[model samples]
Target: MDKLDKQSRTIKFFRERIPAFACIPGCHDCCGPVLASSVEMARLPRKSEQEQDAALAALSCPHLGAGGCQVYEERPLVCRLFGTTPRLACPNGKRPAVMVAPALEQRVYRYFEQVRHVLV
Candidate 1:
C-alpha cells in the first residue's frame, strides 16, 4: 500500500483498537495545544487567532466546543489514544478498565514515528 493508504489504515486501526471512556461531561481539562502532523491538522477546520487565544486562555483545545471536540470525527491519533494508555492517562480519572492491546499500542507508536517528521 502507499503511504496515504497506510496512514488511513493506521488511523482506522487506532480507532478500532483503542478503548473509549466517558470523560467527565463538559470537562475539557485535557484539551489544549496538541502536536500533530500536518496531514492530521489539515483535516480540522482552521481557527482564528482570537479563538486560539481564547482557547489557550481557558486551557482548552481550540477545537473544543460547548458540547465537546468540534473536530472529533477527524481528531488526530494522539487525541484518540488519550485515556487509553497508562503513559497518557486521562487527567480526569476516566480511563478505561481494559487498556489497548500491546501489539496495537506498538503499531500506534510505529505509525507515530512514520508521521513524526511532518508533525507540527
Candidate 2:
C-alpha cells in the first residue's frame, strides 16, 4: 500500500485500540488547541482562519461547540487519546475501565512523531 493508506490504517488501528469512556455531564475541560496529523485534519470540517485564531486566543478548540465537540466523531487521534491514558487524565476523574497500555501509548506517540502534524 501507499503512504496515505498506511497512515490511514495506522490511525484506524490506534483509534480502535484506545478505550472509550463516558465523561462528566457537559465537561469539555480537555478540549483545547491541539496538534493533529494532516490526514486527521482532512477528516474534520474546515474552519476559517479567523475561527481558529479566536478559538486559540480563548485557549479552546475551533471545533468545540457550545454543546460539546462539534466534530466529535471525526476528532483527531490526540483528541481521542484524552482521558484514555494516565498521562492525559480527565480533570473530572473520568476514564475508561482499562486505560491504554504504556507500550501502545508510546507507539501512538511514535506515530505522532513520524507524521506531519498541524495545530488545529
TM-score of each: 0.78, 0.97
Residue-pair clashes per prediction, in order, are 0, 0
Candidate 1 residues lying further than 4 Å off, grouped into runs, are 48-59, 117-120
Highest lDDT, which number?
2
**Per-residue alpha-carbon lDDT of candidate 1 for residues 1-120, written as tens digits (9 for 90 to 100):** 887677767677778878887788887777777766666767778888888778778766788878888887888778878888888888777888898887888888887777863322
Best by TM-score: 2
Quantify all predictions' global Cα lDDT against the true fold: 0.76, 0.90
TM-score of 1: 0.78
lDDT of candidate 2 over 5-115, digit per residue (tens)? 999999999989998899887788999999998788889888999999999999999999989989888899898899988799888899999999889899999998989
For model 2, the stretches where C-alpha displacement exceeds 4 angstroms are: none
Clashes by residue pair, model 1: none
